[model samples]
Target: MSVRIAVIADDFTGGLFVASNLEKLGIPVFYVCDTAVLHEAADGEVLVIATRLRFMPPARAVAALDGLTTMLDEIGVEHIFYKYCSTFDSTDEGNIGPCGDLLIGKYGQRRLVFGPGYPDLHTYVHEGYMFYKDRLISESIKRSDPITPMNDPDMARVLQRQTAETVGLLPHRVLHRGVEFARGYVDDQQGKGVRYFLMDCVDNDDVATGATIFRHDHITTGADALAIELISQWTSEDAGTRRRTPSPVARAEGGEVVLVGSCSGVTLRQRDHFAQDNPMLDIDICEADEDILMARALAWADEKLGAGQPIGFSVAGDVASVADAQAKFGIMGAARKAEAILAGIAKGLGGRGVRKFVVSGGETSGAIVEALGIQSMQVLPFDELGAGSCISRDARRISLFLKPGKIGAEDVFSAALEKMRAP
Candidate 1:
């Protein structure tokens, strides 16, 4: 079937999560990082274009999305979902707000609904503020994020700062009154020139309510929860049953490598938990030269891979160490250098016949995929490896488990290794 839904994910991991959620509902999804392979996605029910636009400047990110709408239009996409992080990760001069504006203009919609709620992940919008579990986002772990630290809980205020258009809130009170009242509220707000509505999605029911309210909207932007709800609503009974039988897991040969570039608390804990048994190399980006780092990491991997043991290399550190590195080499510079080193190590490992990769961090995953020259990867059925597991559609036959920094369990790394090796 031609693609009915198109999800423009701001980052790789978020896109993979959305695709995985759809797969759980038995909807076949084709996920591509490079738009050149859009033709390959015609058979899937949903087309998710994963972009590395999350960290780019607003102007550059907008420019990157310029022709994507046209491409989706040609493919018979009925709905467009702009997927972002559930934490609402963005700066005041956002890649989110500016990109949303661009999408609004492209879809010719006066108002678009924006909700960053994924209750399963303890991220949801209530009233106008975002909460991480029980605490507001300002007081949550996201406050210490190495990139785009969230210091505000009020999402409406946050979004308003990023866009020139008038931003408004769709309070939970209105939503609790049901869809009919909610739709009328949205229509009235849009009539008053509210270009974007920050929705209050505190639970699954709230997400379903938001889905019903914006069911006919040409474009809706939010985290994976909202997309999941919308996709579930759009899926017909027959289509949902078409792929209930899981595809046999693709077998992969050669060595395995785990690369962690995220400094999130969850990732750090996962790294520690995995290190208790498995071999891991901590990448020291602060003092080591890039060439020397690559040489050392490759040599280390060679020994581990030769011994038939899966190994991990990490640039993950505590907040103090991350701050120190950022101070030494500005934030973006430090991040770029670390990503470059990890990407180099991945390339070197791939050359040495390492085919299964368990990668952590969104930017890190993007870099490794780009370095490996992988254009498109099909999202595999939801497995124990959790959200972002996929097999490359290219000749390499590589299997990858791409985990977002904050979304996995303490044993996620070990779980990923086991899942990738399953027959």
Candidate 2:
């Protein structure tokens, strides 16, 4: 039998996207976003699964994980890569005892590689934003964060490490890369195709994936010139196949366009009640399941005619915890939630006259693209992760997206309810 690789996680998009990347590298992929078959492993080389969605009480989550261990043993799953989760806001391991730091101690670290579960940040210079209009072309780069390939420490608090390390990793392609990538982003009527959100790292253990920016004076930019440059790169044959629908015929509408972002519905508290609406749903930061709620949210949107409204929305997901900054924002779970909501909404929006949607969140955008089930995508030179996009037929039903709770939690929601008439 072929060595089967199964990706289990709390969020669907992140797990699936990672699996897809690995698959392109010639790995067979299987996913268990559901808990029912977590232990049901196929014989494989390496298995990557996240623990946050296992959101039962610690004791309960462990029991369930214990059952998974037995299943893994029965299935002969040897190499396992489990995302060692920290406290929601703290980098310390709060509940690893029940989940077996022992087994993982014996096997996980060696078998698993830990880092940011989403896209690495590639900065885009949004022209004409006077706030950033100041000339920093003579900027001196500094070591802002800890070193990379370092020990697995909590990232939320690691400002120095996160910032300094990823500075150069961003695509310098702009200076020496593609021009077409920059064009078609926007027109005068439309806004810039994308924006740049930058930060200097405070602390992130090196060895974590790249693109973890720590701090910042300002974030994000929008400009029309960037769009023209982006669209110039859009050849009819190229973008047509990749588009979520036929590409919008008219000029671009930059930041004004609403995009989908995804995070767990419960984890992403939309209002001041914050953590109250579904306090019952809080799981160990490592143990929440997104499939169930994601399924329901899409269903609710459809039942509610959420697809019909001429609205701009983001389908955000996987808000693991508000406790910590690193885990809270740009984590894999967050990305997964973003992808799932988009998928659910996409399915719901099929043929419903829903046209275009834009994306802001990085990880969520990655999840959306991955969920589209395409082999190779038509991508531009910017931070493809954050590059503004309208996914086509795969998003035929509805467009969904997600972002961290900390970013634009209010302004980004896209759904509107239809008023009811009573006799």
Candidate 3:
């Protein structure tokens, strides 16, 4: 019944994604944002620590993991999973490779497994190159990402530029041979001093095979799919002893607000779709000052606050519009300005009794949550509500539906509101 698995996610939505995957296997998961509460997790529960380090400098990101290994050791955690986006969203100087190197050095492990694929989302890796459906990631919608535009689809080369260690790849052809051959290939690569290993997961079957080969490894890093497969394998080994009581249904009592800050193609489409029925206001980040924008947004929300239908405020726009904003106010400057304006509006809505929040985008979610002073929350099984929905356990009784920028359906906003209000 001791804690066996710990996952360090680089962003809020990624952490919730991993927790939701583990919940699929009925493994109890404690999702926390604050590192100080690591010891508070109950016995037998997996710990998923969500951090806002996705956009931080490599050194700062590595420094944030300073005492995490020691904390996990004290809590009897046997394995560590480093989770990032499926598209391998990182810059040339990364929070992925640098963070992975820190964990490797702390755990004294020779090779760190990297699988940045989630086949369900049409995001998978093959021959060390990442793809979205049939198109290479470099040519996909992710290339337009403002904060971390993925111009290179080669994950091995992408990760190599971030760390000083040698990187290797395990292709799908070798994995198609089976787990035994795949394991031998990985072993051979490690013998040649490859400190990092990226697995080619073109489908769910490849993910399952890779999970089987590394089920008992000291460390396994990837998106949610590999972790889900690994947990399924581990729990099946001793099903009777590993199961824990299911969490109660997560519900909250408050007004609802949908905040959109992602500029991804999917989110832009979702914003347009939701605008057909609900009331939505787009925050202009082009030329307005932060204070003026926040004031204008809050004033607009004052009229739409208690309209029964969920009111939405978005910074999402077409790729051309985003590019225009980036040209006006540098890339990061525009993003930070949008996040600050949204965070301010969230605070204003909270004061007006809006508690059920459906947030779109990773960086936007982090900004809003931190502004609300939320340190931790209990992870709930929200597959029914949507992909990544959960409720806060604090006094506010807030409900959060955190949708990754490029994730969720066109009707995701209305669907989450309907589910949140369902009796």
Q: Which candidate is the best by TM-score?
A: 1
RMSD of each candidate? 1.8, 17.0, 2.0
Query: Whose lDDT is greatest here?
Result: 1
- Tens digit of per-residue lDDT, candidate 3, span 179-269: 9999999899889998798889899989999988888888888887887788777767754336655667657778888899998888888
Q: Can you tell me which runs of candidate 1 are displaced by over 4 Å?
A: 237-244, 383-385
**Tens-place lDDT digits, model 1, residues 316-362:** 88888998999999988889899999999999999999999999999
Task: Assess candidate 3 and give its lDDT.
Answer: 0.83
Ranking by lDDT: 1, 3, 2
| C-alpha lDDT (0 to 100) for residue 411 of candidate 1 | 90
Q: Rate the local accuracy (lDDT) of all candidates.
A: 0.86, 0.30, 0.83
Model 1 TM-score is 0.96
Q: Please, what is the TM-score per model?
A: 0.96, 0.35, 0.94
lDDT of 2 at 194: 17
User: C-alpha displacement of 201 in model 1, angstroms?
Assistant: 0.9
